[model samples]
Target: MSHSPVHPQLRLYFENPVGRLLEHPDGYLVVQYNAGKRKLEELKTFLTQASTLLQQRNWHKLLGDQRVMAAFTEAERVWITENWLTRSTTAHPYYGAVLLAHDVFARLAMNLVMNEARESGLVYRLFEDENAAVAWLLQVP
Candidate 1:
């Protein structure tokens, strides 16, 4: 596995090429991926910023909107599950609801994340629709 230093701009959270790190009024953050496959470095930066936002906002949950997300490589999945997702596992416990798009590759990656999250004791659910995902996340802490 290999990783490069992500662009500094990705650290900004709210505005980035891959997605926007948004806070919802209802509580929790939204990591909405853009309409293209993101490089491993970009995803890493997104997660790094996301982790910071999670801690800063004292939020325990997140909503992942994958409507425009692109396929993640096998190595990327491993990195995310072992490095990123494991790091995301907090003592307070994080909850997440990931909305899967029609993209098969994207769904597969989401499933990988979902499985890894469950193993790491994070409460998470996969959704085929946004409304249901929001509903699930609303019930989380």
Candidate 2:
């Protein structure tokens, strides 16, 4: 991934080819995905790193910027729902605000995963704008 800096307020935590994990000054996590097809292992590694950071920080809020992301494979979606989301929520009262991509297929795939995440006790919302997503996350305790 390019070493370009992210938002001034976000501290870069971890990054790989698939995505970058960042920490907000307001005690939230940020995950911004790259635009490309990725392997399941890559996705898992990326999310696992984010989960580790969340556990370490005891942070419950996540801002997922998926604006340029491609569609997730069925297996990838299942893993997110069944493995990552479930485990992550066990550590805190997790809340996520995701900025949806313009790609309809990506949005549909994420909707499926997030539906399961919600059932697993995650409070989350989808957004079209980053500022709106961050604003909402800041309001959640």
TM-score against native, each model: 0.84, 0.93
Give lDDT for model 2: 0.87
lDDT by residue for model 2 over 9-85, one digit each (tens)?
87889888898999989999989899999989999999999989988998999988888899999999888888887
Stretches of candidate 2 above 4 Å error? 1-5
Off by over 4 Å in 1: 1-13
- lDDT string for model 1 (76-131, tens) is 78888888778876788888888776689888877877778888878887787777
Model 1 per-residue lDDT at 140 = 70
